[model samples]
Target: MNHGIEKKARIVGLFLFIGIVTGIFSIAPAIDSTNYLTEVNTNSNQVITAAIFQFTMSLIYLGIAILLYPIVKRYSQSLSIGFLSFRVIAVSLSIVGTILMLSILTLSENYVDVSSNNLLEIETLGNILKSSRDYANHVFMILALCTGNVMLYLVFIKSNLIPKWISFWGITGAVLSIVASGLVLFREIDIITVEYMVLNAPTAILELVLGIWLMLKGFDKRILKADEYENPDSCTLGTIHNG
Candidate 1:
């Protein structure tokens, strides 16, 4: 692989790793618990840390899209653009979720101080915030991510940028992710439940493998050479012969 392509692959892989780690850490037990309204105040630091990690993960999501766009666009401009757009949407929703988490923490602080007469009202608002956060983080955000990942894997499959099996695995995982998100949206399953986690596990595992592959091996050298030959004048391919 050329220096440019190799460098991009490594960075993308690193971002994927960071994104996954942060995403996992971003789930604050206090805010995710059933009695979050009463628990968040006691675990304020945990909630804040989770929010920070979530924000970082959102940025990493955007970064991965931006880094991959140029390469994927060479194979299919429309798919690349679609992938980038969906990732942007996912990142935006993630940030919104993070904000909602902090909002819930604030509500928790108030819930602790409120009198018994207003406890019900505070609980009601807390529920609304919690639900909104769930939808933003788990439902809508996952849908967008799945959509983008499908597009990305499609490009990879067509271009042979990575192994065919890996690309197929990505597509399958994306489909599973979409199903999970749909179930959540329809109220058939709850967030953080065993069913939901199982549905998401494939995608999470795929990402982990894909990240390691990209970091270690980068794209398929044969495909890169083929692409370079087909588009000799392309800026991205111009350096293929050099490094």
Candidate 2:
């Protein structure tokens, strides 16, 4: 198998696994909602479980992304820098996002458990939930935007390891993510609808496509070693090889 293809397959596997785990966590919230209506205390445990599951999955995904960056870095100079930089940003944002999600889940579960909520107390809780969600979405959206641009630039300008169109799709997905996040934080739109359609699903699909392509085809080792016909940059193909 091509080296890139193998890496892509691993990434696809990781993302798919994340999707499945997240789906399971999503269901827990619905179940907890039902428990809320039925006056059951089971929701707390469920929320805790969901939070743990989500955090674990996110950490695993970040870990895999971090590990892969260095391996891929060696194949192409331009791609290496971009990948490493992205890994740093993604890891940071993702950690913060996970914290927010977990905090929201904790707060929501507690709210559901409370028997009586004063108007002032309810308002405070609402603010907390809203703030947590908003922060998570904002940070994640920015990371997505940066990731998309970096991927596009690396593929289109720095290296030709993967097809140009795949990177383009990544860019599109990133744009949608930004829009979706903005709507969530600024437009008072339905969270589930915008997140599922415009951000999460598309980003996952794009990542899968790109990952598979990379693992199967690997990177173009020569792209990093090439020189521009005129006004070559120091990181240009030829310079990368010698440097």
Top lDDT prediction, candidate number: 1
TM-score of candidate 2 relative to the true fold: 0.62
Per-candidate TM-score against the hidden true structure: 0.96, 0.62
lDDT of 1 by residue, 87-107 (tens): 999999999999999999999
Judge candidate 2 against the unseen true structure and give its global Cα lDDT, from 0 to 1. 0.53
Residues 39-152 of candidate 2: C-alpha lDDT, one tens digit per residue: 223455665565577566556655555545543444465665665566556556655655655555555556666758453585476566545644554545355545634554
lDDT assessment of candidate 1 = 0.91
Q: Report clash pairs, candidate 1.
A: none
Q: Assess the local accuracy of residue 43 in candidate 2 as a C-alpha lDDT between 0 and 100.
A: 53
What local distance difference test score does each model get? 0.91, 0.53
Best model per TM-score: 1
